[model samples]
Target: MDSGFDLVSGGTDNHLSLVDLRKANVTGKDLEKKLDEVNITVNKNTIPGDPQSPFVTSGIRVGTPAATTRGFVEEDMKVIGGLIWETATAFDTKAGEIRAKVAELCAKYPLYE
Candidate 1:
């Protein structure tokens, strides 16, 4: 909420958040690609005042409830945050490395094991 992102509902009191990306100037489609390249799943969504189509929304919705339910703690959340920020800033060069790291983290808390 403090990162200047126009978060829906002013901010989240739950696991999910809607991020308005007009300031980032990157559509949700582009941002979604970046996150997916690193194995992070997210969905594009519309926010208040969004001027883009739903399929190419100007916002992205992200959440951590699944990871948390799988035993990921705050430190893991922090790492995920860094990965996401890295994606936002420099995903083209870091996709492979970030994906590897995400795999490693997920392996540590295997969901099916």
Candidate 2:
């Protein structure tokens, strides 16, 4: 919500949120793949009145349960939201930097211990 991206249905009440990628000038598939490359997992989803096929959707579904379980808090999530925006807005140019930042963030809350 704090990110500049447009929330498909506006404020989410759960761990999941659907992001409309039209304004970001990127496809759901594109963002999903880019995020995956940086170790952030998200799924391509079709938004209302979607023009693209389900395989190449116009939206993405992001969930926070895993991050929450890993001990990420509100500030961490806000940082993540900013990272998502940066990734969407500058997919090619910011990959390496974003990846490094993601690794740093994840390292703070190791999954194993």
Candidate 3:
């Protein structure tokens, strides 16, 4: 993958991205929990060749449709991606910062007028 992300099926041709995190030594459930803690919604996924249970998957599924629906654009998605990465790698230390950023983004792109 471009940024060295461990992607499933090698790459993506759609809106959704399936990230294999086995080599990272992290579980999808933990990653999802970390993302959720900072308001970055994501779902656990079963990547090809995954050897873990669904409840403790080795991958995560991330998409930007909901954010786009809330008025987010390409740049915002990039920012959110960075925040997600930070939170995934260092949840406790980056929670406040990521949450604040997510709040700012959501406010700028509110669901309703």
Candidate 4:
């Protein structure tokens, strides 16, 4: 593993995995904002190597396999990507609408029976 990347224990079985951002040039806050605009949902995580408190993190990780399994195709991915990008660029103004849209999309393709 690289100095910045920490592998998830047992690997990830879900559509997404959390990645530490200390290695990357971006911050969790910035990445979160960007991902939100494109409809990509991700969680902020703490860098394992950090000496600071873990409660607040400096990394954001995102994935879309779950949505894909739920019937999201390339077009959906594009839409999601756009939303994420937008959110990253302009978070405060677009967060609510983007969240609502994400909900609507999720409703269209439920995860379970």
RMSD of each: 2.1, 1.0, 1.8, 6.5
Put down candidate 1 lDDT per residue, 84-111, tens digits, no spaces: 6667766778888889999999999998
Q: Write the per-residue lDDT of candidate 4 for residues 59-104, one digit (tens) a residue.
A: 5566766777799986776666556544554566887887787888
Per-candidate TM-score against the hidden true structure: 0.82, 0.95, 0.87, 0.52
Deviation of model 1 at 68, angstroms: 1.3
Better of 1 and 4 by TM-score: 1
| TM-score, predicted candidate 4 vs. hidden true structure | 0.52
What's the C-alpha lDDT at position 52 in model 3?
91
* Backbone clash tally (model 2): 0
The order by descending lDDT is 2, 1, 3, 4
Give the top-scoring candidate (TM-score): 2
| Residues 14-104 of candidate 3: C-alpha lDDT, one tens digit per residue | 8898998776577999989988888889999988878999889989998878987887887887787677667767777879988999899
The residue ranges of model 4 lying beyond 4 angstroms of the native Cα positions read 1-26, 33-40, 43-61
- Which candidate tops lDDT? 2
Candidate 3, residue 1: Cα displacement in angstroms equals 5.5
Q: Write the per-residue lDDT of candidate 2 for residues 7-105, one digit (tens) a residue.
A: 988879999999998988899999999899878899999999999999999999999999999999989999998888889998689999999999999
lDDT winner between candidates 2 and 3: 2
Report the number of clashing residue pairs per model: 0, 0, 0, 15
